[model samples]
Target: MMKMKRIALSALLSLGLTACGPMEESEPMPESMFEEQGSQALDAACTSLGTGITSHACVHSGNPADHLARTASATRVTSAPSISTKHTAYDIALPSGAEGSVTYVPATTGSYAFYRTQNVPFTVINGSTSATVPSALSQTVSSSGCLLVYVSVHDLTAGTTYIVATGPASGNAITVVPEFLDDSRTRYYRDADGDGYGSTTSIYTACTPPAGYTTQRFDCNDTVGSGASINPGATEVCGNGIDDNCDGSQC
Candidate 1:
């Protein structure tokens, strides 16, 4: 459907250029200040992403993680599959030049991110019937000296082989590292009292743990300031009628 629309638009543009009369000066409009500010904020966000394969930043995430790991950074170069396939509905239509497709079978089902070392358009096709558009794609980040730079996020299913299509590449070799974003997030519990221990009732999941949160859990009394002195590590006061050590009994 999308490919047909693009073809029609190209034909219309070609005809207009050939039949054009006297052309007038068309001054380009200035970019909105608000849009520029938003772009700067996005750039700042990319810089703050941590250093690792787990980071969501536009920069390369080294090699793929867990079962998805293929090889070291230098040796992961893979040949792009020819655009020709039995399923032409999911084909990527480029104005000129041949495109490529690669079969990607994820190890686990989750929100996966794909990073391309080259500055080419990348798409993930779920099956012959449907193709997924990236939910999150980098806008400000650019490639840095042969390193993977551009990135996009898509929901992938484990065991289901999908087609990863890319526009005509420079050298016909493209390295697209796919990482499971869900695996990167660690469970964190809220530590409101600033104590080393945390309450399981209040928990968070994120790659980067949020402020006032910790990995430690099982705080019997997480009641703000007073709870600071009440944790699993605290000594049990026998007659105080409180389970100071969180042992489920006071004695």
Candidate 2:
């Protein structure tokens, strides 16, 4: 009986040991993982800009239209023939010491009038009022079978500005568009979970931020609860395993 009791005790000990298996080791996250995620998030954000628009970082000092139009000659082209016109606004980022260009492709092959307007505040070019083109603001026009308008970044201020291009009425459909010459060093933060907050370490520097990203970087846990409590001054819930205040601590 004693031997049988000892055997039963040993069996129980073995079963207990089996139940308490070895702890599984967690895999370490790769260092480049954050960077890769950030890039993907940024791509999504920029893709949302739709067609003919781009994202970049540059300085727009002020509305050049205010000064440009104010200084523009008031002599209107009275009795000018109004033709069916197509208008396009180009958003260009002109970094200091750089240049930008826009291509104007006319739908038809005929003499087309080209007009440009600077991105100015409170100025809307609805293809109604026609202002005389200023010689100072005239872009260097080039012909490669199509018209290419080039503007120097050195002449632009730091911020967002606009350039309006108007094509001739008699030609093929004219498309005015802005082109990015180079990459911008603008910083954007990754918000992989679509939370308003972004990860501090997961940062991207480009002219535009990708989808699931933002210009702001203040998220404590980008992957937690769809970015719950990721904003500044967020409440820290005790024992929830989340950094609500982005302070790297959970209550």
TM-score of each: 0.47, 0.31
Number of backbone-clashing residue pairs for each candidate, in the order shown: 0, 18
Off by over 4 Å in 2: 1-185, 200-208, 224-227, 238-242, 249-251
TM-score of 1: 0.47
Per-candidate alpha-carbon RMSD to the true structure: 22.1, 19.2
lDDT of 1 at 216: 82
For candidate 2, lDDT tens digit of each residue in 167-236? 2212212222322312223445677766666666453343234567676666766775667556655777
Best by lDDT: 1
For model 1, the run of ten residues with the poorest summed lDDT: 67-76
lDDT of each: 0.53, 0.36
lDDT of 1 by residue, 159-228 (tens): 6667666766665455565555543444567888888888764422323455677778888888898888
Superposition TM-score, candidate 2 onto the true structure: 0.31
What lDDT score is found at residue 8 in candidate 2?
100
